[model samples]
Target: MTIPPGPYSPNPAPLLARALRALRRDTGLPVAFGGPVSRDGRGFVIEQLDGARTTSLLRLRVQAGAGLGGRALALARPWVVDDYFAAEEITHVYDHAVAPEHLRSIAAAPVVVDGAPRAVLYVASRSSVDFGDRLLESVARVVQLVERDLAVEEEGRRRLAAAPPALHSAEVHELVAELSQIAATVQDEGIRRRLVDVCRRTRLLAGRVPSADRSPAPAVAAVRLSPREREVLAEVARGCTNDEVAEALGLLPNTVKSYLKSAMRKLGATNRVQAVNLARAAGALD
Candidate 1:
């Protein structure tokens, strides 16, 4: 399947910036630095820091299970070297990059998303104080925060895609709330716009009428729907059969049937058609 284009896809610059800001706030560390590492079809590159210099610059290139950062990515855990030259656990993949910077004490943590390592967060210090558990904890907290924000955005997108076009004002309002929350937390302009787009679409769908002469339906009160349920209802309102909805939404036909049945029961409708009509009347279908 084609991956949807999103601000979170690549270009780890924003995450790095946020990570650095958090790192700097940790009073325990005299120095901190971070960059993103990726292994893709084009190979590996450390998306360099925007405006910072260090005596020792840690770099990891395309190779499996090599160097401190690469090993962290491979193993999906944080790794640290109190003394880089003396650390005998792994081979230095970027000796050329590390040597010029005079980096000695180093720590690396994988910025994991889902079950895979997407990138690494590395911090280095000149002195050999081991960088400690405090530094690692700080990094983990920052990563969790970032991941939470991403999860919000992802959930909002899923809801928007799943929701039927005939949603009631209440359902639309609920989605708007979710979108607004996601938009507020996201730092990326592109992601923010996408959230806004979802809100606009929800508004449009809710505002529509069965006929020009008929007054626009009253808005539905705010009501939350799970992302999957919203998607199923959205397809149903668009006049799609269960099989069609399932195919479009990447769900089994039985699952789509169950979602529609559940939605019908929740909206207190007798059948699929009534469910759509009542949801519209209740202002939930927008």
Candidate 2:
């Protein structure tokens, strides 16, 4: 198959911002921000500058292998500089960005998705301080969360890109959807990963078929049921009580109830029975 040549569709900006915020919250860092690499995958552009007093660092671009951020991205690991101006490992490519923000110390952690550096997360301080191992460890945890989410998003895109020559049938779509729900509750990591790959490819196959031949609405149709809501509703359709749904889905009972309520609201039904009826009517369920 001829893979298309272009940037991956997953937007790392929102996730990057989230990871930065989590980093700051966890490590008590005064400033935290980062951005995705350029579309060609060569440079870093600071799109999500959080905890900044001034907008001086917003949209700051750093070339690959240039600044501290660039080096982190280029080498695919975390890099720390005790003093931003006096750091010898990196050039002053982003000095203009650093000084106006009064950042004296910083560390950059690269979030890698699919073996490539996708974003560089930075935590900084206005005063000179050491970016030590404990902070780095905390940052690593945030990076893991970010990378997990990015991998999920990329798997979604690959579903679209991997669509087969023929569009998929409704039965095929239904099978894949059910399999995904089953996979969600699995315990083994390797098995879960394989199931995810299977689900992605199955979706890719299911999407290529003529729309008319598919199961109910697209997973996210106009009267969209969120994936979680859909999962809960699917169980409810089988006469599962809220507690039962919660146990099956590995969710809190209150959380299951919340998903049920949300699903009911979205389907414009006053009760679970009515909601299931509406879902079936809309082809959102089998």
Each prediction's TM-score against the native?
Answer: 0.58, 0.65
Q: What is the lDDT of residue 121 in candidate 2?
A: 89
lDDT of 2 by residue, 141-245 (tens): 888878776675566546545555565465555545554544455433443555556655664565576667665643334697788988888787655678889
Clashes of 2: 8
Number of colliding residue pairs in each model = 21, 8
Error (Å) of candidate 1 at residue 222 is: 19
Note the Cα lDDT for every prediction shown.
Answer: 0.62, 0.73
Which stretch of 10 consecutive residues in model 1 shows the poorest summed lDDT? 1-10
Among all candidates shown, the one with the greatest TM-score: 2
TM-score of 1: 0.58
